[model samples]
Target: MESTDLMKKINSFALRSFRDNADRDYIHARMAYRAQLYPQCFWSSLHALEKYAKCILILTRTERVRIKKNNFDDVGHEVLKSLKMLESSLNIILSQQTIDFLKRLENGARFRYLEVSWHSESAELTILDRAVWELRRYCNSGLYSYENSPEVKLLDNVKELLQDIENVTVENTHIAGGRLEAILKQPKSPARKELVWKNLYFSNSKRKTVWLESNFMAENSSLFLYPEIIDELTKYTRIPKEIVNAYKNG
Candidate 1:
């Protein structure tokens, strides 16, 4: 019921969802490419890259800003926007060629729907390949940073403790002749409550909704993390600690 508990639940769900979506989009992109669905492949790859970029943003606690009034769609599908966010927030420099490719593939209107003249298949494939490679590198590096982070270790510790408790509870239930009611009635530990609370809190946060939205074409005006989570994420993020701290305190 406490705010901290609610935030823990939300963080868990958000992290899990981010991980799943990143992998799913990347796999879909690969599948589309292998099937010779060039247009679909281009668009899917862009989506995967965008999702991965957003994950980096969240991990580094980057705050999104609205540059234009009532232009949510512009912010959401703009690959350039994501790149710029990474650059400005985490100092992740993207090469100009990479920027150009992403800008071309920013929205699916020109490629996905066949709105533009068809290009040579080989040329398009080359472009797509390069984009995928660069984006994959960025994503993998971000994930590596996350994996080595202290916050991840803390979260893992919480998960292990929860698992241990569950294991003991199950054993007790078995010892008591599988009395389901007694096991179900056992008091939840503070750690358990905290984890559940975070999941629930984050589930309701805008960060989760924005990232999970299926309409990749739609623009999202803002992207941000819950401040409390941001505070903790800042501690172990690759972004400059001063910048993160300033964002948190500002």
Candidate 2:
């Protein structure tokens, strides 16, 4: 096969793996929320959204030219920054409310280490639902053919999860217990029932295997060995020999 065809296959495989990983995080986030583990939920939600944003970048842009700033690392963990960077290129606009939630989620991510106390409104999960729903809608819009890819059940299950939670009140750290427990004990919708069942299935070896395989490739492949080289080449027609030499020696 030609190099272009090879890259396309590699990219397609990578994209599906990425989407699966993102769904893994998303599933765990929902589980955390249902269990009233707000902090874990926030962290997982942050990762899920960041990966979703990156997936959009991969889908729309070339591997070497995705984002120009900070060697395509400027978006980093900032969901809003990633969305803003994609706005012009993808012509996708997020509602101000979703944008605000992303900013809040960025701040919430810092609460991971318990260095500071933070208070988030109970409706934050609802906002997260909207953000993920929007991104997934775009992702499944057939930007590329996925006829050969294995079905990611979480993709379909999450749509119903989002719908079920659309009106249900999701509590936050500041206002925990009582109603939260009551909500969890309530009769589960068919969607929630399936979510609970499939969550366990998706959480099994299949999820870990896909992520580990993707990570193994990323770590072992020379293609990702020197992102700095990609950065220099992105900025200039030719890479400075010194930069190449430094990587060669370092």
Candidate 3:
């Protein structure tokens, strides 16, 4: 959901940057789809998770979610830019060096890594988790900069948002990079899982659906898919009555 709005903003930014691309429409559609699916197909897909996991940079903003570590010391965005560029061409077109570089960065889980801390990698996983969560939140909230303008105080917007975040002094809060790794290693929830299905998707109508039921067995990343969600999705496959009865009856 955050990515949906983010895709629009990113496209707007691209338009401003490129002025015009001959293949603007094609690129736009691809970028938008990836903006939504990259996290799912490439990153969230356990089968393919490792393929992009190393490229998944953990970013953090102390004042606000806008200031990338790169503008200061954060470089994760740069990695994302490069990887996205490579992803633009799915074929053997992006060059081997580019792929190699990304692979190296990903293997170390230190590639394109960015954050504000001049601290130790103590709570590496925990810090990584926070960084991912922050990026997700950033995608949801929005980022702003005065790069093209002046008289703007740096990190002021972040300060504004920080006023609202209920910063709790929870346990393991200061183990440095531990947070980030924790988030990175954690599994994504499946679309048809219990929390997702029961909380946001499921309804009496969902029961009669059949498409999801059919595909449930076909999904590659069923780990995120909750069994309860699968059961719920069986109800809403949109299949005809005979199948629905057999499904509900059986």
Candidate 4:
């Protein structure tokens, strides 16, 4: 139960991991993956909790969209609003003290992460099987290539642990470019990027400053989003009849 012992166990689990088995870079990447999986605890140990939340909120959306530059538009408006709500909600839950404790490491990986399980042996097997299932599906669908992609190494755990995995090829997948929701990544998107930059950034101000109190100019406000809410509410929430039967039979 000692920290040293727990780390040793995690390392042992990694050594036996499918990812590490594939290659060394994979080994390192897998470590990062594990940390991200439980960032609630891992992030706090490395960087300040407040910074990590900002990083996660930013990076997650960025990765989702894979934006080289920025994209701002009417579609981006909703995303900005959602971010404000999400940020406020997170801060409200974590509190200032806990946020400080959690956010000690935002720059790089240089601290401890919470272990998945006490027994490295079991943890290895579990992690491996999940990787296999996830990657094989991507591979079968033609969304990934093993020879060139880090995705193959990521699935190392699955290849070792899965007993009877159905081989999935790239042809079997429907997702292209990683995932469906890819447009939300750019700083050009509505909310803070443009609003903050144009309104908040002034001749006297500097960049990277998150200024809250300013002569911020919001768009001419009316019943802007209220109509969309009404539109969604009027739409039927019922599932299709065929899918309903499939679920019932299962």
Candidate 5:
């Protein structure tokens, strides 16, 4: 499809929907992290960040935003670059640690392939949680009050958009913040500390044996979805079990 026609298919309402999709990605990332599916976690986190960045660009940039297929034009799968563009364009700064985390995620294929890699214990997920929180804040603000430029107004549904922007109220997704915020900002609990330790060295034979023997595995049993890990994540992230189960079932 032509880029302009594609842009016409997207509007402020579609832009607002990114928050919901990103929230689901955020939830999935945490679930994968809890499940010790680090590769999946990395991809999910990257996806969540990419969507948030694109959403931000759509809201703040006056230029035409081209989304061909599932890939953002000139920004395919490189979340760090997308975020840098967002930072430069919107003057929204991110911490050096967050930048480093996104850089690590940029090579997510390595993690997926189980190649030798370096990732911090708990810190990766924490950075994702915090970054998502900040980005979601920008999205919510833009959704409710952005004055679309004349160029943006060319997109379909812009005329009907945000009539109730003042009435916009987001629920407590991981981005909207709750337990995840507390976990990010406050001290960790003993279970959380242990979970982090286990995640850090999940390759240890003894820990792996115990972890496998435990009932933490998902319904398939081969996937090894740990309940204790989920509990720890829930303690910190406050994602509902239904959402976690949705990820598990699908």
Candidate 6:
């Protein structure tokens, strides 16, 4: 593949993996919050938003040199750095409240070691969840835009076609082999079958074919599914009824 195609594939794969990973982190964070594991909740929430920021940067094709210059390449957990880069590189403005929240969350020691009880109350948890939701919404919208672009749509269609062809080929090859094996097992031509089977065995012995299983990640892991907190939070926090209902049904 050409360099451009290679980059596209890399970015596309990163975007997808990061997006799903971010969602997984978010769900885990919520689970931690509901369980009152405050430190884990804070850490997981920050990591989730960090992945969201990285997804935006990757989709924008932000250069590694640029990220390195900003020192974002050095610290993967620096959500603020990613946010700043996203703002500067893409001319996108984020809320000051969100920025401040991220800055406070960036204190690695606090969340890592349980130095502070930042999310004790339902209101505090709601605030943190709102920030996470905002970041998730933004990155999701950006990814949606890229996915719906003409070039990406075309590439996705071609990939689906190729996968379909591969599946059909595998199925047909298995069917043909089964049919041949059944014919070879028939009792009427024992001598002939033995001769043919020996020849086939010798021919197969001369060449080795290794079948490797594809390790593509499953798209619908249970971890990514919406957790029970989506409904529980509504009872604790003053989240709007419509929003809560939508989330519950979503």
**Leading candidate by TM-score:** 2
- Compute the lDDT of residue 160 as modeled in candidate 2: 48
Candidate 3 differs from the real structure by a C-alpha RMSD in angstroms, to one decimal, of 21.0
Give one digit per residue, the lDDT tens place, for model 6 in 1-250.
2265665676666556776677567656656655556667668878878887887666665667876886666447877777677656444344666677777668743324222224343333444544654454334322223443322222223333322321222221222222223434555743333223312121113323323223222133121254455556457655445444654565
lDDT of each: 0.43, 0.52, 0.28, 0.27, 0.50, 0.50
Residue 115 lDDT, candidate 5, scale 0-100: 24
RMSD of 1: 20.8
**lDDT by residue for model 4 over 2-74, one digit each (tens)?**
2545534433442234122322222222343344343332332222222222322332222224232233222
Q: What's the TM-score of each model vs. the native?
A: 0.44, 0.53, 0.22, 0.17, 0.49, 0.49
lDDT per residue for candidate 2 within 1-250, as digits (tens), equals 2255654665565456655567667767877666667777778888888887877666545334545643555566777776666655454545677777788789756434432345545555555666765564444324433343321122443344333423322311111222222233555533344233323122111231111111111012231354455554546555445445555565
- For 86-124, candidate 3 gives per-residue lDDT tens digits of 232211122344344334334334211111011222222
Of the pair 3 and 4, which is ahead by TM-score? 3
Model 6, position 29: C-alpha lDDT score: 67
Model 5 CA lDDT for position 250:
53
lDDT: which is higher, 3 or 6?
6
Model 6's TM-score against the true structure: 0.49
**Residue-level lDDT for 101 in candidate 3:** 36
lDDT of 5: 0.50
Q: Write the per-residue lDDT of candidate 1 for residues 32-144, one digit (tens) a residue.
A: 55455656766676776676566554544444443233233334645667656555334454456667778667744343423223332333443443444444333322122
Alpha carbon lDDT of residue 82, candidate 4?
A: 23
lDDT of 1 at 191: 24
Candidate 2 error regions (>4 Å)? 1-4, 62-66, 69-74, 144-250
Off by over 4 Å in 1: 1-15, 65-74, 107-112, 120-130, 136-250
Pairs that clash in candidate 6: none
Instruction: Show how many residue pairs clash in every candidate, following the order shown.
Output: 15, 0, 41, 33, 0, 0
lDDT of 5 at 161: 36
Among all windows of 10 consecutive residues in model 2, the one with the lowest summed lDDT is 209-218
